[model samples]
Every structure is written in C-alpha cells, then in structure tokens.
Target: MLRELEKAEQKWGGSNKLIDQWLENRRKLLVHYCQIAGLPPYTNAEKSLPSFEHVKSFCDLLVDYVSEGHFEVYDQVINACEKFGAPCKAAIQQVLPKITPTTNAALDFNDKYAETQDDQVLYQLDKDLSELAHTMETRFELEDKLLEVLHSKYSEHAQQA
Candidate 1:
C-alpha cells in the first residue's frame, strides 16, 4: 500500500539524495491525485459540462509521474544497483519489463483522453477513468516491488561495496 511505501521511503530514503528527492516527488504526485479525485464532483466545477480541464490536469499529472519514473527514478534505481554491485542487477532488469502492461495502459488512456477536444460530460470517461485507476494501482504495486528489491536489497549490498 501507499502507506508502506511512505514508510519504506522514510526508513531508507534519507541516505540517498536521489531517493529522497524521488520520494518527495512521489508524495506530491500521489497527494495531487487524491486532491483531484476529491474535488465537488469535487473542486472547480464551473462549466455546465464535466470538468474537462480537470480531466486534462489529471492526465497531465499522470504523464508527469510516469515520465519521472522512467526518465529519472528507474534510471537512478538501476544505477544504484550497479553502484552497489548488487546481485539483484539481473533480477531488477527482469522486473522492469513487468511494468510494461501498466505503462501501456496508462499511456493509452492518456493519449485517448488528451485528444478529446470538447467538454463532454465524462460519463463515458467515468468508467474509463475507473479502469485507469485500477491500472494505476497495478503500476504502483509494481513500482513498490522494484523499490523493495532495488532499494532495500541494493542498499544492504552497498554496505559491502
């Protein structure tokens, strides 16, 4: 769960600058997501139509989160594995591919929703967003697994490095 991740980050992130920053980013992204989901239908519902701006904002945040994971966090984790000379290097590589399904699902949702030009009431998107939420949860679990192996194990290995 997210709470476990926060604990892991707190327990393990302090020593590593990259990890500390990454955890901070993760917290921000998760909080914003919760806030977005909590708004009046919940916040900033001025239009007669469903808040497409809100949808866009959420989609944008999702992209930012994923981008940071791929372009920054995952790469840092890989580097940490190598730097610590951890035996999990190969196993971590294997784990990376397992994230593809969730990544593809998210990217597909982002692409589909991003191109919509009108203020459709999002009734159709409600079901789709719900499915995307499930996919995001899957993605988070996969990410946590990576952190467990990549951070906990590798940090342990770092002592021997």
Candidate 2:
C-alpha cells in the first residue's frame, strides 16, 4: 500500500495544490495505519495493540481525509470538469457514484472504532483495520482514475486554449 502511494505521489504530486494536499493527507493516514496495524517499518518486534491515542489519531485522520475528499477536493474537481465541458463532467459523474460506497465503508469503520473504550473493541481492531485497508485501497484506485481522466482532459483543454 505504501509503495502504491509512493507511485501515486510520483504520478500526480504537483498536478494541483488540492490533489497534492490530499495525497499528503493520504500518506500521513497510511503511515499512521501501518504503525497501528504493526506493518513493517512502522512495527516493533514485540507486537502489542496500538494505544488508544494512536487509534483515536488514526480515526481522526481517516474521517478528515474522507470529509475533505467529499467536501472540498471532489467539489473542486467536479467544478473543474464542468468548466472544461461535457466529456470530463460525464466521466467524473460516473466515477463519483462508484466512490460513494467506499465513503460509507470508511465512515462505518470510523463509527465502529473511534471513541470506543471497550477492550472487546480492541480485539476486533485488527480485523476492522484489515477491512478498512482494503476499502481505502479501492477508494484510492478510484480516486486515481478520476484524477487521471480529469488531468489528461484538462491538460488537453489547457493546451488547446
């Protein structure tokens, strides 16, 4: 996942300020996730559950990232597509609907784990994290596709202008 993120950054790092910021948020979110999940590099040899603070922090990032994408970045992209005209607009409309399920899954994960004080919840954390990771990977791929289409079309329009 980290490797995939690095590749995404290389591909779209400076394409737009909003995207750059969103990608940076993604990087932070992933790093925090790795530490919490005990993935390598962020893992210690001893494998204990992540602290409450770590879980809470990760949940915060997760929610913030989702909210930003829905509220800010997606809006900007949609507006840009609209301004660029029909082809870009239609492509984004299709992609945005596909992304909605992932958003729901992410929020479900956050609601289940965030602010929980139960040790039982901690026991379920590992499984939930794995699921969330899968959801995020799907979301990222969709987002990348959206960005690729938008950028390519927008670039062409810009050049022709």
Question: Which candidate leads in lDDT?
Answer: 2
lDDT score at residue 25, model 1, on the 0-100 scale: 68
* Residue-level lDDT tens digits of model 1 in 45-69: 5533345676677778777778888
In angstroms, give how far residue 86 of model 1 lies from its true place: 6.9
Local lDDT at 133 for model 1: 72
Q: Report lDDT per candidate.
A: 0.70, 0.89
Give the Å error, residue 120, model 1: 3.8
lDDT of 2 by residue, 30-137 (tens): 999999999988776877778888898999999999999999999988888888788888999989998899999989988987888887899899899999899999
Candidate 1's displacement at residue 123, Å, is 1.4
- What lDDT, from 0 to 1, does candidate 1 have? 0.70
Decoy 1 TM-score against native: 0.76
Candidate 2: regions farther than 4 A off: none
Q: List the residue pairs that clash in candidate 2.
A: none
* Pairs of residues clashing in candidate 1: 39-42, 39-43, 40-43
